[model samples]
Target chain A: MAGENMVGTVAIIGAGIGGIYLAAELGVAGFKLRLHDIDDARLADVRAFGGIDVEGERGGFAAVELATSDLRAAVDGADAIIIVTGGNAQAAVARSLALLLRDGQIILLVQGNTGGSLIVRRALDAAGCHADVAVAEMDNYPYSCRRLAPARIRPIVAKRWLQIAAFPGNRIAAVHQRLSPLFPQAVAAPNALYTGFTNANAMLHVANCVANAARIESGDIYKFYAEGVTPAVARLYEAINAERVAVAAALGASVPSLEEWFDRVYGVREASLVETCQRLTYNSDGPYQATGTPSSLEHKFITEDVPTGLIPMVALGAAAGVPTPAIDALVAIVRNMTGRDFAAEGRTLARLGLSGTGVAEIIRVMNEGFA
Target chain B: MAGENMVGTVAIIGAGIGGIYLAAELGVAGFKLRLHDIDDARLADVRAFGGIDVEGERGGFAAVELATSDLRAAVDGADAIIIVTGGNAQAAVARSLALLLRDGQIILLVQGNTGGSLIVRRALDAAGCHADVAVAEMDNYPYSCRRLAPARIRPIVAKRWLQIAAFPGNRIAAVHQRLSPLFPQAVAAPNALYTGFTNANAMLHVANCVANAARIESGDIYKFYAEGVTPAVARLYEAINAERVAVAAALGASVPSLEEWFDRVYGVREASLVETCQRLTYNSDGPYQATGTPSSLEHKFITEDVPTGLIPMVALGAAAGVPTPAIDALVAIVRNMTGRDFAAEGRTLARLGLSGTGVAEIIRVMNEGFA
Candidate 1:
């Protein structure tokens, strides 16, 4: 049915790099588009340009059907909604969508950031919006992109593979059917649990960032991955990744080791994780090349990732009865460094509405509905 | 009294900076010295020079009665045995002394790195030595010195104050009596627990090393304290110090906060730990100015300090039921960085012969002996 009647009108929220890329691709592909961002300046640029200019990989002056800062008008009658506001804004976006969303609509988080769907679903329930909508998430953004100008985006490369799944995973088939056209590389994941655990960025960013805390603060310009991920740092990555894999296993989710993921995804056939990172840093034209290390400890690598990435993993590990000592230690250290208690302020399972639930119940809720 | 009849003969172990500095000072002070080192080359240099050439502050041609590679010959007939072989060599030195030591000879660890006295005493007991020797420890090396050549050293500066304590709290007076003549600034601590917890080096080294791990590995030459102790890194130091203070409190050992210690010891008054470190680094002629950042993670900042310093602190904290989450986290991170399971390989409470004991028992042992 999804193949027969490909959802025509699409709502793209958050005019960030990912959101703009999604809009440009879908708009050029003949799907009607409405783009929304809380930043009026960005929306004004989009409106003035009449649409976004796409370059590299995909090229077109993709016109939008609607560009507005209005939340309700953006998704007024769209068949599908793509949220790319990042993990920090996920809860607020979810709350706004809860009131405007109609029945038979689909919501997808561009990158779930470890339990994005569950968090959005919980926010929807809390706001008393019980619309018959399907919520889904991808492991990461489909494109590595940058905004050249206000309304100009360069999509450097589209990811070769991604995992997509809906909350209460039974609905993944329907969600995957619709998403596959836009994301040809996406394969249906068993559930959001699979997608969440496969978030390699969560495991990768924090430790390396912490390891290079002084370099970042010293106002020195250096390659984050190339210079930062030394042998010891790479070893830390392996250690943290092992803990992550154990937690995933305890939750009945299968995930690749960080080394395996790097090898499989990047085609970096190095002897160790350290070599893999070094190879990817110098040789690849991927996100690693485009990315800059955080300017301060307050940057997203710690501020956003600690709460959305590590804290959630720690909470999930605790609920699953799997020890995440390395991850837990990281959270404590970050807390000390920043004077912020991530466990208290972060995305705990309780905040995601999975409190008092054991491993079996968590897996059950993840596969089935919250009911 | 100690002043009435001072120890006339002293055995100096290891020919490192601390050993050479001790030997030079005591030899110039007119006490007979026998210096021992496993390295025959260093002994050859000392023999060739006819004695150690001392420079800076207290300069003299300090003669050694004997400088040999033989451990038994080093300690034979010496009234005081000074172990300056560093923490790594503590166990082997203790075992060797167990066989060679005689009655009424005092054994002192130059820098008791958080339970050094206890570990040495345990080794002696395990080796079945029942000599009436008082095993004592000082909080840190008395002089911040460097060796210019074999058998030649420059005493940078004597520590303004140092804490000396015996294994049992009650024997401190006797140890202090002999030690004070050599170390005029030395004061009596309640017990080795007080001296151990007051070890500011262990609290300061690892976290800052980890924060600048990539920099250290990159082989970039920089001042360790000035460039490395950025704001976030200083915050980590404070957090670790807090944990150390709590563990000390639980064991009835009082120690200064890192900030307080900086002010009291270095006379660098500042608003925060960050400012204090910065002031000391740029303004003072102390150890911070002279010490270079480690070339690799395998340096003593991680390798030597972790096992002998942090591991013991964590063990003591555990015995006292004090949760050292930050310190424990630092240990885990260091373990990850170095590929060493510090908790397993480094000192544990059980390893120090303090297993199956609670807070009250630990404090009791600190005041009393193993009996």
Candidate 2:
């Protein structure tokens, strides 16, 4: 803890899966911790899980001396604020934090899917509290936690290396220094764009689950890590990866190949995306389950991945002249399968607030770090 | 009946559905009729149909003065022959006819699907027949019939138009003059390729059935005509149509739009291919039964349409700089779905024996008729 003395009280929001995991890790390492969540039951469970015993009515992790859903109370005395809310609740949480966050109090977003950091930054700007609150985003959460009960969480694999970066390049090292002690794996990405594009799991997993909706709805008997590597599925995986790479390239970031990411994350070697998915979900004793919808793949692949991930990549690919036939095909199939106008839902140059900029200008802006 | 006296003696081989219907039409029109089939029971049913009688037994139709399983006997005295056998039996039937047929006889093949005329022509060449035998093909037989019971034939809808064309070009008028009275709707197509591509039902209907196998097999009710036009299935129809159009263009023939063909064949305005199939097959009064092995659409669409119809189209489109994203997407999706390498499955240019020829050459050879 190089900054142990200087780093004051740390606030962990949501006390949900990610929040609980992070707070437990940090509390064990002797950091003064505050946890906030709307659910009191969750707070009670965290208290039982080795949190510092705090004798107060704010019954959270026994180690978390402060616990509340109040925005101001949570951020009042904090040096650092970490967000770990449900994906759907993120926008509201960001809006609330924008009003209450103080200057020089850093905001870190775990699992920053679909430009969460950028979204929160915009919220803070609208609230007139944008300066001095250095906002950063991690590609994914540092730890995997599943709920055992309403208040109980079971932490599984804590990722060994987490890529993160601040919106403004100036805050990179300072943010990393403050948060590194709480995570075993924390590294700075080039910028928010690099971190955003590297979160490939949403695109890959969602597409696979959606496309195989019939099989998934009947029963997810297949191992996603192994069977998902079938040649057909592998092509889809490649298409998705191609899109992600395109987005990263457009943003002037070097993104790793999906295959390399798979190797790093799951220890899969020479196996296709489908194979990797099948091995993990079907062959292994993992906690994955099938989607309930007939077009789950469409929902994830087309609705979520296309609108949020691939469409943005497609726009970028067009700029680069990289013929992404696989990505295009996936988009078409998902649209056909779902009968939704995904392009309308998608991130366009206009949607990404880059409307009027030429490719070069957009790339320059992205390279300069979302300022 | 103007050429009743000059009409040549006609032999219809294979007393199956097509053979029986053609024999019934021609025998009543005062042409010397001969019907032959391998199945004795089917031929017996052809005899039981009223108003026709035969003098001899080759296989079973009563209008045949002579019938025999021996091919030489059946072909010996024939002036014109119509081959109506199953596609799988094409080679054997062609060999039988070539061994015994005299020069100057006209052989009109019904349902020249999978290039049956080409197969027959190759077999005849192998048999070393060099005489001026006229080989013609009809897109499909002019009548729809089914076997109701042993020795009983059920006549359904008689197609209003039958497009016929003679290969080598010179004998077209003569073949039409001989068979015109028997078929009220006889018209001459430019060549076999025109007839092949115009039969769009084979291309679209088959793919729909195969892709929806799970729903079809599960007895989940489906109004294939009404509901199968879902955007996803419609995209598939478009993909299949694109392939057929490509093959037709390659052969220097005009391929009608699927919508246009449906109106012409089924008298339904704006009805999709699935609707046409439902109208034709699922009708209570229709000749076809509800249960049968899934038709060869699976093979045709996947094997033929993808490689022959789609791949060629994609290639041609590429050469012509036309963007056929719909066709391309379908090819990818089907390739992924079936895991079958359709490009290698006889539908591709190389497999179709058109390898090494530029686009112009392909068009010329198919238009000029098989050498």
State each model's CA lDDT, in order: 0.83, 0.60
lDDT of 2 by residue, B279-358 (tens): 65666544233334333224433454455445545554554345666666666656654556554543344434555666
lDDT of 2 by residue, A1-371 (tens): 34542456789888755687677656655778888887767677555554632212322342677777677788886888888874445556877777677667878877666566666676677666654788888877665545555444454445656787886645678777776766647787767767777776555654464344334433334444444334445665666676677767855788778777656655554544554555545433233323123333443434555666666666656655566666676667556545676778666655556666666665555545444
Candidate 1 residues lying further than 4 Å off, grouped into runs, are A1-4, A24-32, B1-4, B27-30, B128-130, B146-153
Tens-digit lDDT track of model 1 for B35-116: 9998877788777777888886658889998999998998988888999987878988899889788888888898888888
Badly placed stretches (over 4 Å) of model 2 are: A1-101, A105-129, A140-162, A168-170, A180-183, A201-229, A239-254, A270-274, A287-298, A354-364, B1-231, B234-300, B312-323, B332-371
Predicted structure with the largest DockQ when compared to the true one? 1
| Interface RMSD (Cα, Å) for model 1 | 0.8
- What is the per-residue lDDT of model 1 for residues A1-371, given as tens digits with 9 covering 90 to 100? 14444677889999976788888877777788999998877788789888888886558888997999998999988888989988888988999889888888889988888899999999898898878899999887776666788788776566667899899799998888887777788889998888888786687889988888888888877688888889988888887889888998899999878876765566566887767776666664655666687888888778778888888888899898888888878777788877888778778988877899999899889999687
